[model samples]
Structures are given as structure tokens and as C-alpha cells.
Target: METIGKGGFCKVKEADVRVFRELLKKSTGERVEVTGMQHMAVKVFNRNVLKGQKTSEFDPFTGCLKMSDQLQSIMEEIKVWERNSNPNIVKIFKLYNDPTVPEMYLLMEKAQYGQIQIDLEGGDYLTKRNAEIEVVAVAKAGVHWPQGSGTDLEKASKWIFYQVAMAMEYLHSELKISHRDLKHQ
Candidate 1:
């Protein structure tokens, strides 16, 4: 079986439940449940594009989008956890390599709750009231200050900015890698 995603990659059926379950146990070092299982994504790389590819810096939105290269980028992201640990970042569990197909599968921790970013900013997705309610809830959750006194939103925002800057500083100065894309999302 095969499946495709918009502007992404192709995927083929990798394994059935029994084999996959055993594979997950071996990889994760723990018994786990895999649900909504589907074909693993495989990048289709172009030789012509590879010929001129010399830089790591590339526009993610436009011009000769290479799926294979993007998969490599994702792999690099997984590798970063080996060196640095950050609570804000997502954890990648394992990497599955299929020599026959030349495809890699990244098994990651699945979040039971839907992404807040998608809930809030998903295209034409949030209605007015929903946005307002989410904003209020976030605002309430964000408050922190002197023992009892509640901090203002600006203060909270500044604190968040500082924490993020600290993380970037550590990454750049210590890890020697630039985040490149740093924006409030």
C-alpha cells in the first residue's frame, strides 16, 4: 500500500501489526501501542536538484523543494537530542531504516492532545469565540510573579522571550548551530 501527503513524500506499507509491535518493543525498549498506523513516508529525491545542492540554507517555502533533503533535515533534528536536552522540544524515540527501500522512519512520542498551535492558527479553523476563549485561558495560565502578586502579560511575554533567547544562546554559543527561523508561533 502507498499514501501521499500534500507537498510531502510518498509512503509504502512497511509492516503488519504483529511484526510492527515486535519492532516497536525492540526499538523503544518498552511495549507500546501504535494506533492510526499508516505507510511510512519516503522522500523522492531528484538527481538534478542534488547536482546543484551545496548549501544547507534553503527556503522551506519555495524553489526546488526536495523531499529527500527535508527528510535528512528531520533526521538531523532527531540526532540533536543525543547532545542537548530541552524540555520545550519534542522527543524523537527511534529511527527505522529500511535498506531495501532506502527509507527511514522516525518513531516519535505521540501527543494525545491536539496541538494548541493548530487549534489556534489552523487556516480558517478557529471561530471568534474559540480564539477569545483560548486567549483568555492561555493568559490565565501564563500569569506568574512575586509570591502572591500576579504578573502582567507583558512581563510574562518578556520572561518567555528571555527563556527562548537563553535556549538559542545556548544552542548557538554552545551547540554551534543557528536556529535560523525564530519567531513567536
Candidate 2:
């Protein structure tokens, strides 16, 4: 595994896992076996950061302050991701919790282009535009609607704005959650 990114409380690493595929029936009724290695991103949370923190923070969703701060935050994030089905959102494959381990692991889908923050820092104008386009494209790809073509920057900007607005609406109205820290990164 190789470290790809790191934040205050989490470190992201790139890893490959071998997965076995069962035999599948082909169109011609013949059995075919396939197996391959899948690339994934492992987000390891640093539990030490929450070691001495108070656990009595009030939770709006639960209407109670019963759970530990660390566990509450982790559970809330997992719940949000579990309820989210948006393609634009990074998918969480699995969560690992072990008694012996001090930290938790979240196995997630690897983004091909990487974080937008790094791309923007590279000073490429098209990188930001492409990132927005990619996000909008993924968000709208599942819907059955006629989407016009062309990579116009103005159009892309509008598309990105509208997509974000819709996502906010979904989170607020549908999921009853508010994202306080919203940023391009």
C-alpha cells in the first residue's frame, strides 16, 4: 500500500485486493471464470486524535448525548454515506472495526483523477474545469434526460452550480443533514 493523501484525522492509501469471481454462464450457455485485482482507497482514521475528547456532545439527529464523541461522529458519517446513492459522491465499500485495532478503516472506491485540491494546486486551468465537468457528468449520468453536449466553461459552471444546489437540497430536505464546511476541495 502507498499513502496517497493525508488530513488532520485520516490518511488515505492506495491498495490492490485480489477478488475471486465465480463461474458465470455466457450467452452461449458456457461457464466462464474470471478473477482480477481491484484498486481501492483505504481511509484510516486516527483514533488518537479523539482519545481524550469529551463524549457528551449533543446530537441533533439522536436528540441525545449518550454516545461517545468519537463513535458518534464515525457512526454519523457512516450513516450519511450509507444513505447516499449519488454517483458523484465517493462510494464507501466497507467499514472495518476490530477490537485490537486502535483505528478504523474505510475501504472506498478510488477516484481516477484524485482529489480536486491537488489538481487545482498544480496550476492547470483545465484541471478545475474538467473536475467540475466530471462531477456534473457523473451526477446526471443516471437520469433519463436529454443532456446537451459541448464543454463550454460557462455551461460547465452553471451545471456544477445546479448540481451542487440539488445535492444540498437532497441533503437538507431529504436527508435532513446540513454540511457546514462546504468547499471546492
Candidate 3:
């Protein structure tokens, strides 16, 4: 398994899985069995991480998460992901929750594009901790980045902004759900 991303208590790994799809047969009013393979990102959440954490008897919503732990939150997340089907949202295939195991696996579609890097105006690319940071140093008070020549870059940035905005709008309007944990990775 290839590790793709990481979280506070979990890590995502990429793996190949076999899937079966039912296709409609035009000639015979029947469905055809089709086998396919897909690359899936599995989120491995370790419940053992809660060992040292203090979980109070009084399940207050202050910081203890209303007495419910990360497991409950993950379950709720799985339900939301399983219900929603959109182009902007990543598709969740299956969730493996075993009582005997300390880890829970959440299977999801592998995202191809992680982050977009556009050389704005004159930003210096700084490689730090496996992530690239574009540092824009303004020399003067009225100076700005993305000077006139970056027309194509402006369009691409605008397009990305629109797509993210649309996705957020769809989640709020159509699904009536809000993503609490939004991250770059």
C-alpha cells in the first residue's frame, strides 16, 4: 500500500481493488456482469490513538465531542459520504468496521490532482516539509502579486475558484451538509 495522505489519527493509503458493475444489455432486457479494477484510497483510522486521551463520563460538547469520540464522527462521515454522489465530491466505495480490530478502513476514490501550483507574479518557491510554499514578498506598500502578464494564470485560478465554490454551494444547497475538516492534502 502506498501512503498518500495523513491526518491527526489516520493515514490514507492507495491500493488496487476489484469491482463489479452491472451494465444494461440493449438486445436482451437483462444486465451484464462487468468486472473492473480501480485505485482506491483507504483511510486507516487507528482507534488506539484515544488510549492516552481523557474521555470524561459526562459527555459534554465542550471538547470531548459530546461524549462521542472520533469513531462516532467517522461513522457519521461514512454515512454522509455513502449518501452523496457528485462530481466534485470524492466517491466512497465501502467502510470496513470490525469490532475485533483497532483500525477502521474507509475506501474512497483516489484523487489524481492533489494541489495546483501557479507561479504568481514573482513568488519564490520554498520547499518545506514535503510541501511547496510560494512566498510573495511585497517590496513596496502598493506593490501586488500577479502582475499584468499573468492572464492565463488568472483564468486558471478563477476556474479553480469557481469549481471549489460550486462544490461548496452544492454541498450546502443540495446535500444540506457542511464539510468541517477542509484541508489542502
Candidate 4:
């Protein structure tokens, strides 16, 4: 697999065609061929970073006992993604756990435009301005928001803020959950 990105605790790779097919088959119980398919991003958590650590707590929302800090984080992320159907949030396709390995893989939709930080740094003036607008909108909404073009930043930012605020209100009031690490990225 070719490395596409990396973070402190995870590495994002361009999922290998063969491996992707195998994973899809395993996940869906159907043979899937990767022919002209959109590439999926595989986020592999570093085992070393999560080693020798565990946590157990009662989840107030799920009313179930959560175990292991790393495992809980992965499970919580998947749960949130599954519960939310917002267009602005990233979509998670599947979670792969190999018994032989300590690491876990998160199969997710690949963002075509890439990271916002890189875009802010290298993008044209308009792109940079739009990204800044998105950041401010997200902050105002207290959640994630989509970035786009061809509209006045003031009006577009307000709409983006409204959409994200509604989404967050739903997550908090209805789902009884919170995204503690909301950020521009």
C-alpha cells in the first residue's frame, strides 16, 4: 500500500486493490472487484502508540461497558459516523480488525481535495479565503462544515454555520453525544 498521509497515531494509505477487494468481500460477504472504483483511504492505527493501555467505563449513551481506550475510540468513531448522515462529515465505510495484528484499520471515503491545512498554505487566494470562511463558520457552528465556491463568503458562511449548528444540535440533544475535538481539519 502506498502511504498517502500520516498523523501522530495513524497512517493513511491508498488501499491496495487486492487488499481492498479482500476487505470488501470480508465485510459484505460478497466478492467485490476493484475495477474503476473510487479509491478508499485506509487509516491504520499505530499499535505502539496504543500498547499497554486500557480503559473500562460505562457508556452513558449506549448503556454498555466500554473497554480499552484505543478500542473505545475506534468504536465510538464508527458509532458516530453510522449515526450521523450529514454531508459535511467524513463518511466511514468499514472497520477492519485482523486477529494477527494489533493495529486496526478504518476504511473511509477519500477526500478529493485533501487536507485543509495544505490547501490553506498552497491554494490560490480565493481558495485560501474560502477555507478561512469555512473555519470561521465551523467555529461559529461548533461543528464541521462543507467548503465550496461561487458564493458571497458572508452569506455562504452563514448558511454553512446554520447547517453545522443543526447537525451539532441533533448530535448533542438527540444523540446525547459530543465531538470534543472539533477542528478545521
Number of the top TM-score candidate:
3
TM-score of each: 0.46, 0.62, 0.64, 0.58
RMSD of each: 9.3, 8.9, 10.2, 7.6
lDDT tens per residue, model 1, 57-114: 4455676544445455654655774566655443444555544554455444332222
In candidate 4, which residue pairs clash? none
Worst 10-residue lDDT window, candidate 2 = 19-28
Give the distance in Å from residue 79's predicted Cα in candidate 4 to where it truly belongs: 3.1
Evaluated against the true structure, the overall lDDT of model 4 is 0.65
Q: What TM value does model 3 have? A: 0.64
Backbone clashes under 3 angstroms, per model: 0, 0, 0, 0
After the best TM-score superposition of candidate 3, give how far the Cα of residue 44 lies from its true spot, in angstroms.
0.6
Residue by residue across 2-56, what tens digits does model 3's lDDT show? 7766667788887765421111134224432222436667788886664434432
Q: Write one digit per residue (lDDT tens) for candidate 2, span 58-158.
A: 57778987757565577677878778776656678667655466777777777765754454444444334345445655555432222545544445456
Off by over 4 Å in 4: 1-5, 16-19, 22-37, 53-68, 119-151
The numbered model that scores best in lDDT is: 4
Whole-model Cα lDDT of every candidate shown, in order: 0.48, 0.62, 0.58, 0.65
Q: Which stretches of candidate 2 lie over 4 Å from their true place?
A: 19-37, 54-68, 119-151
lDDT tens readout by residue for model 4, 94-116: 67666577778877777654554
lDDT for predicted candidate 1 compared with the true structure:
0.48
Q: Which lDDT value does model 3 have at 117?
A: 44
How accurate locally is residue 44 in candidate 3, as Cα lDDT from 0 to 100? Answer: 87
Candidate 1 has a TM-score of: 0.46
